[model samples]
Target chain A: MTFNRRNFLGVAIAGTAALSAPRVLGQAKPHVVIVGGGAGGATAARYIAKDSDGAIDVTLIEPTRKYYTCFFSNLYIGGFRDFASIGHTYGGLASDYGVNVVHDWVIGVDRDAMTVTTAAGHSFGYDRLIVAPGIDFVEGSVPGWSTAAQNKMPHSWKAGSQTQLLKAQIEAMPEGGTYCMVAPPNPFRCPPGPYERVSMVAHVLKASNPTAKILIVDPKEKFSKQALFEEGWNKHYAGMIERVGPDFGGANVSVNPDAMEVDIDGTVEKVDVCNVIPAQKAGHIAHAMGLTNDSGFCPIDPATMQSQVDENIHVLGDATIAGDMPKSGFSANSQAKVAAMAVRGALTDSRVFPAKYSNTCWSLIDTEDGIKVGASYQATDEKIAKVDGFISQTGEDAALRKATFEESLGWYAGITADMFG
Target chain B: MRERVFFALALALGGAGEGAADGHAEAIGDAERGAEIWVYCSGCHQIGPDAEIGIGPPLTGIFGRRAASVEGFPYSKSMSRMGSDGLTWTLTTLDAYIENPLVLVSGTRMSFEGLEDPTERADLLAFLREYSDKPSNIPEAAPTARPDYPKLSEETLALVGDEAYGEYLSSECTTCHQRDGSDQGIPSITLWPEKDFVVAMHAYKQKLRPHPVMQMMASRLSDEEIAALAAYFGSLSN
Candidate 1:
C-alpha cells in the first residue's frame, strides 16, 4: 500500500471516527469523581482525563472557584508574591483537560453506593473517588478562640482573605509593638510553615517597625529545619524575634480575642498582633465519611493510596497520615499523581507503575535567603518511608541562598502549572 | 536489498554493525524507550528544536559536535579545556560520558551520576540522535563495549518473589520514594518493570552505579531479597 497524504488523511479520518464511536453509541464512560479541588484533587482530575483520552469521565468538586495555595501565601504576607500570584482558577482543568469542574461543597459520601452528594444537591457517581479535602482547624484548640474570633486573631493559615487580613494587621503594627504567634501542636499541615510565616512576618516588620518584637509560643520543642530557621531568625531579624518553648511557658497557652490578651501559663501578655495557627485535623468531609483514625487523619495503603477504611476511596495530601512525608502542597501534589495513576489503572485496566514519591519544602527567609528540606520516598508495606534527604546548611553564602530562592520560584511556577493544568 | 544498503551506509559512517543494529531493530533500545530514560536527563539537559539552555546546555544537534560549543552557556573550565583538547560528541563518546561524566572529564560541572544501565544509556542516545541534524547518520545500535548486568533467570523469577517478604524488605526503599507517587527531583519507582528493578539493584550492589546511598543500600541486599523487592514493587498499581 502506497503511503501518501491522501491515504494518511483517509486513515486519520477513520481513526477519529473510531475514537468517537463510543460516545456516538451512547455508551456510559467510567466516571472518576474527585472531592476538594486542591493540589491533590485537581491534579488527579486532570491526569485521569488527559491520560484516558476521553474514556474516563472526570469531575472535580471544589467549593471555591479559585484556589489560594497555602504553599506561598507566606510569601504574599512577606510581600514577595502578590495575592493574584497565589490564586488559581479551574478554567484550565475544565476547558483544557475536559474535567467537569463543579464548584460545590461535597456534603457526604455514600461508599456503598459509590456516589457523592454535594451541598448543591447534585449527586456524582464514580468508579473511583479521591478525597483530598486538605485541612480544617480544630475548633477551640486555643481557649476563647474559634472561627468567630478569626477576624480578631487571624489564623491566616488557609490563605485567601485571612492571609490579606493578617498581612494588614502585621503592616498596621505600632513601632516597638509585639506580634505574638501561637503555634499549633504536632502533625499539622506544613511542618515548617509556621516558622516560614514567622520569618516572613519578621521580614515585613523589620522594614516597617525595626523595633517590633515578634514572639512564638510553641508546644513542640523542635520544629522542621529548626537550626536553619533559628539561624536565619538570628542573622536576619536578630533581637526582634523571641521563641518561647514549653520549658519557657510556650505551651499551656490561652487567648482572649475580645481583650486581645494571650495567657502563657497564666502570664497575660497583650500584643499588637496575634497570629493563632490552631491545632488542625483532616477536613470535615473525611470525618463525616468515617475515613479518619483516632489521629484525625486518614490511613492509607502506601502502595496505592487506597484508604485503610475503604478500598473504594483514596486519600491524598495533608489529609492522610503520610508516614514520613510532611503535609505540604508538594507532598499533596506528589500523592495526587500516584493516586491518579492507580485510579486510572483500576478503572481502565491500564498499566500500573510502582509508587515512588518525593517532596521538597522551600522556606524563604528575608530577601533571597531561601532554605529547603526534601526527600525521596517509596511505598513499603507498612507506610511511605523516607529515603535520603537534604537540607540547606546554615551560614551559606548569599549567592547560593539567592540561587536556592530562585529555584523555589521556578518550583512554585512548575507545581502550580502541574496542579491547575 | 534496502536493509543491506542501510547497513552498508551505517558501517561506512562508523556506526554499529548489523548484529547490534538488528538487536536495536527488535526494540531493545528504541527511541521511545530512550525518551522515557530521557526524563532523568531532562532535569539538566534539553533536546529538540526550540530547546533553550537550562542548568546544562541544550543538547540539540549534539551528535558529532564539539563539546561545550553552545554560546552563552557557562561551561566548567574542565569542559572548555576538553572541548579545546578535541572532545567531540558522538554515539560512542556520549555513551561513555553519560555512563560516568566525572570519569570522562574529572572537573566537569555536570553533576548527573551518569546512566549506569547500558540499555538505558543506549535508549537515551537513541532519543538524542533524533534531535541531531544528521539523525539518519547516527548509530542505532548499542555500544559494543558496555557493562554486563546479571540476567534474571526464569528460575530466579519463580523462586524469589514473595510479596509479603518483598514488602518486609521495602521499608528502606520507601525512605526516599514517596509512596504517594510524587516526583520531587527524585524519580518515582512505583510499578517499575520487575526485570529493570532487579538489574538496577544488582548494578547498585556491584558498585557499577554512582549514587553512594543506593550503592550502600544495594550492597546489603541479596539476590533473592532484590527479586522479592522487584516482585513487591512490580505488583503495585500506582
Candidate 2:
C-alpha cells in the first residue's frame, strides 16, 4: 500500500473501530496493550506481534498519530534534517504488523484487572502491558515558568510543535541578541540533549545572526560529553556560546517568560529568546498507574524491563530508571528490544537469549562534525552494567568526525526501521 | 569447568614442544566460546558472504589469506607492507596477530586492544576457521560451527520468486518500511538497493543479524518463499 501522511491518517481514523472491535469481543489470543507509541512502545508492539506471527494480539495506545522523535529533533533545529523527516505515523504498525493502533489517551491502568482505560471511554484487557510514555516536565522547577508560558520560552525537549517554535525563535532572534537557555537538572531525558540543543542553536545563530550570544544556565557541574561539546563550541562557535554551571550560580536560575528575563543568582538579564528545560519525571501516566517510585521514574528489572511494582507490566524508554544507560532514544530502543524478547518468551514460549543491550548516541556538533559515546551492556542480577565503551576523543580529524556523522544517519535509518516497522 | 580443565591439560602437554612443533593443537579453541568473543569483533569487522566493508574489512575466508589481501579494502601502509613481506594468516599467525596486532606488525591500524586471554584468542581462531571458504587445516581439537542455518547454494539464488506472490507476503515488512523507501530501525529493504534481497534474507535466516525473531521468521520460510518476498520488495523503487 502507498503510505503518505494524509492516507496514513485516513487509515488510522478509519481502522480504529475495526481494530478495537475484535478485542472488545474477548478474543482467546493473549493481548499485549502498549501505551505511548514512541521508541519503546512502538518497538515493543511491533516486535511482539511480528514475532508471535498473529498468535498474540497487540494494541498500541498513542495519542498522537504522528510521532516526532526527540533523538534527531536537535538536527531538525540545526537545519540538518527537515521537520517532516522526523515525524512518523502508526500506519505501518497497524497495516503491516497486524497491530491494533488506537489513537487515544490512556487515562488509567488497572494492574489487578489487567485492563487499560482510555479517555475515549474504552477499556482494553491485556495479558501483558507496556508503558513507554517518555517524560513529563516538573512544574515550577523553573520559578515563574509553567506550561502556559511555553510559547514565549519554548522547551523543544518533547519535539513536535515546541521544536518548530524553538527553531523559529532562534531564526527570529535580533542581531547580537542573547539566546539564554535554562538547562534541566540531572536524570532528565537525553543527558547530552540540552548541550546538543545549545550547539544547534549556536549553529543557526552563527550563520543567521553571527553576533548573537548563546548562554546556557546549567544546574549540573558537568554534563554528558561535556569536554567534547566544549571543544566543539570553542572551535566552531567561538565566543558565541558560554555555559554557566552550578558553581557559578547556574543552578540558582529563574525565568520570567512573560518578561523574557532570566535571573541567575542575583543578577538579572533580559534575553531575546529563552529555552527553559525544567526538571523532568517519568511521563504522568506512569505516576497515575502507580508505577513510579520515589525517584519519579519507574524501576524495572534490568534483565526483562518488567516493572518492579508489577511483574506483568513492562516499562521502557526514558520513563524507566535504567542503570548506567542515559535517557536517550537509542537507550530506549535498546531497552524495548530486550523487553520485547522477554515478552515473546513469556507469551509464545520462544527461545529467550540473555539480555544484551547496546546504545550509541551520536550528536552533530556542527555540519559534518559528529561525536559519539557508546557502550555494550549486559544485564546482571542487579542492573544493566556497561561492559566496554568508546567515546570520540577531542581533536578527532574532520574526516573521521564526518564518518561518525554519516554513521549516525545510518543508525537513525536503521533504528527507526527497527522501531516503526 | 570440564572444558577448562581439558584446555589446561592440552596446554600442559604442549608446553615442552611449544617451539619445536606448530602449536595448532595447543591453540585448539572452543568455537562456541569463540562465537561469544566474536561479538567484540562484530563492532568493526564482519564475517560471512554479503557482509559489506564496514569500519574494518570483512573477515570471511580470512584464514590462509594474506594480511591486507581483501580487494577494495584500504589497508594501512604498515599492514600492506607486512602482507607484501609474505605474512599469511595461518592459525599460528592469526593467534599471534589477534593477541597483539601492533606487536605482530608494528604500525598496523587495527585499534582493538588485543584479546589478552589465550583461550579467547584460540576460540576466535576456531570460529574463524569454521567460516573461512578455503579453510586451512583444522587442528584435531578445534570445535565445529553451530548448526543453526544452512549455507546458501547457487541453486537457491537461481530459484525464481514470484513478485506478485511476494506482495502478498510483505505485509509484515511494510509495517516498518516506508513506501517511499525510507527506513526506521529495520532498514529499507525495498528496491534491493543495498544488497541482493535473497542474500540478505539468507543472512537473517542464518541468524547472522542476531535478531532472534527475524531468525525465527526467516527459518520458517522456504528458499522459494523468501525469493518471492524478496522479488516483490526488491522490485520497489524509492
Candidate 3:
C-alpha cells in the first residue's frame, strides 16, 4: 500500500500518459465526429455531448436536415399516422445538447489523419469516429429495376418520398387493380416490414377498393413473426393478399417498371402498381471508407461496436452486421449508446460500464391490432447473445392487442425522443 | 379477537368512521372512481371474489393485513423481513404506499409507480379496500399509516449507486420510457423517489411486473445496477 520505488516508477509512466490527454493538456476538447445522423449517429452524438458536458466536441454530419424514420412509414401508408409525424430534426441536438450539426454529405475520410472531409470541403479532425449510415439498395439486385426506374415502381424501403409515391400509386389503382411487391431477401431492414406493408396496403384498399388484391414475392423461405403475420392476414385481409415464397420461385423474379408488370419465375403478370425492395448493402459511405466486408455489412466488435477493420472507428445501426440484433431503429439506438459510452470512456476517462443491447419490433396489421417481438441481449465473447425474450401471442385478447398497439406509439415517442434529444 | 383489535387499531390510526364501508369510502376516496383506476392494478392484484396470488400477493385483504401475509405468494426477501417485523396495512399506510411505495419499505416488491396525485391514491386505495373485511365502528381514513419497524436493514439498502454507472445503465430504459417524463402510452419513469424506483424495477426483475418489454429489460439488471439506475433517474426533475 505504500508508494515505494517500484510504485514511483509506475506512477511516473502513468503520469506521462495522462499528460498526453487533450483534456489534461488544455488543448481543444477531444472531438468526436459522427456520420449519418439518423438513429445511431444522432443518439451517439446526443449521449456524448450531454454526458461530457462540454468536455468533448461532438460534430454530427448528415445530408438530411429532417430525418424520417422508416420504422413507422408503413403506418403512414395505412393512414394511421400523418407523414409529418415520422420526421424529426437535429435542432434539438444542436440547441439542447450542444452538438455541432453539419448538414452536408461526407465526401471522404482520412483515417490515418483522423479527419473527415465533407462535400462542402470542410475538414473535421476527430479523436473518434462513429459511422451509422444505415442502408443502400444493391444496384441491379432486381433485374430491370434500378434507381433510374424508381420513379415508376418506387422502392419505399428507405421511406421519404418513395414511400409517399408508393402509397399514392396503390391508392390510384383501378377498382380491381393488382398491387404487387417484390420483397427483399434475408437480413433486410425491418424483418416484418414487407408483410406489414402489404397489410397496410390491403387495409387501405379494403376501404377504398375492396376488390383490389395484394401480392408478395419474397425470396426468404420464412420471415420474422411469420405465423403472427399470416394469422392476422387471414383474419383481417383474407382473400385479399397472396405471397409466393422461394419454394414458388419468388426469388427468381424481375420487374419491368415502365410497363407496370412483374415477372415471377417464368410467368409474366400485369399489375397496376409495383414496389421493388431490392437487395441491400451497407450504405455507400461505409464502402467508401473501406469498412465493409464481403457480407456487404461492416463487422464490429460486439462489446464496443468498434469496427473490426479500424480500431479508431466505430460503426452502428443497419450498416453493421450486429449479431442476433435485427436491423431496426431500436437496435441502432441501442448500439449507439454503447458506442457513445466507449467513446466517452476512451477520450474523457468517463466510467465505462458493461455493454447491454435490446430490441423490440412492433407491427400493426389492421385497426386496433398490433403485434411485437423483443429480446434482451448481453455481449458474449462471440456476439451480442440473446438472454431473454417475448412475443405477442396469437389469439391474445383484443384489449391486450390494443395495449400493445398503444405501447408502440409510446415507444415511437420514446425512441425518437431518445434519438433527437 | 386479533382481527377486531387490528380493525379498531386501523380505524384509530386512519382517523375515520364506519360510514365508509357502505361504498361511500370518502375516508379514502370515492370507491366508484377507484374502479376505473382498477385497470391499472388488475394485471397484478386481482381483487374481489376471485382474488388470487398472481404476479403479486393478492390485495384480497390488503387493508389492515400484515405486510406480505398472503401465504404461498413469492414475497421479496426484504418484504418478508418487514412483514416479520409486524408491519400492518391501514388506510393511511395504503395511501402512503400507493402514493410512494418504497418510502415505508424500501426493498418491498410492490412495483406500482406510486400514484402521484393524492385523490387518485385515495381512490385506488378505496377500490382496494372494497375487498377487505368490512369497516367496524368508524371510518378508517386519516394520514397515520406507520410501519412498526420503520427503518430498513442497513445491509440490504447499503449499496450507494454510482451516478455515472447509472447513467449508462439507464440507456436501455430510455428507449421506451422518456427521460423527460413524457407519458404517451408507456408511463414516464423519470424523477421517481429513488427507493420507489428500486422497488418498481425489482418488481420487473423478479417477474412481478406485467409488461413484457419492461420485464425483459429489468430481468438482467443486477441489484447494484438497478440501484445505480434508480440513483441517476431519481436525480432528474420531472
Better of 1 and 2 by DockQ: 2
Sum up the clashes in candidate 1: 21
The sequence of per-residue lDDT tens digits that candidate 1 reaches over residues B1-238 is 3443343233323322332454542232455566666667777776656779999999888988977789999997647645643467866667767876744454578888778778787767766666677655555443564433333456754655767557545534553454455544334567676765776676556644433445556665667888889889988863
How much RMSD separates candidate 2 from the native structure?
14.1
Interface RMSD of each: 10.3, 10.8, 7.7
Which structure among the candidates has the greatest lDDT?
Answer: 3
Note the Cα lDDT for every prediction shown: 0.77, 0.76, 0.81
For candidate 3, the docking band is: acceptable
List, residue by residue over A1-421, the lDDT tens digit for candidate 2: 0114344334333433345432444344667899999888988888788878898889999999899999899999999999999999989989999999999999987665577889999888776789999999999899989999999999988999999999998888888999999999989998889888899988998888999999999989889998999999999999998888999999999988778999999899999999999999999999999999999999999999999998878999899989888888877877887788777777665656567666678899999898888766778878888875667789876755775686578677766777887
Query: Alpha-carbon error at A171 in model 3, in Å?
Result: 1.0
lDDT of 3: 0.81
Query: What lDDT tens digits, residue by residue, belong to model 3 across residues A1-421?
Result: 1113344334333443444222233234677899998889999999999989999889999999899899999999999999999999999999999999999999998776567888988877677889999999999899999999998989998879998998899989999999999999867888989988998999999999999988899899988888999999999988999899999989999898888889999899999999899999999999999999999999998889999898779999999999999999999999999999888877766777789999999999999898999998878878888899998888876756776788899999999999998
Q: Give all TM-scores, in the order shown.
A: 0.66, 0.66, 0.77
TM-score of chain A of 1: 0.93
User: RMSD to native for every prediction?
Assistant: 15.8, 14.1, 10.9
- List residue ranges in candidate 1 displaced over 4 A: A1-27, B1-238
Poorest 10 consecutive residues by lDDT, candidate 1 chain A: A18-27
True contacts kept of 3: 0.81
What clash pairs does model 2 have?
Answer: A414-B185, A415-B185, A416-B184, A416-B185, A417-B184, A417-B185, A417-B186, A418-B185, A418-B186, A421-B176
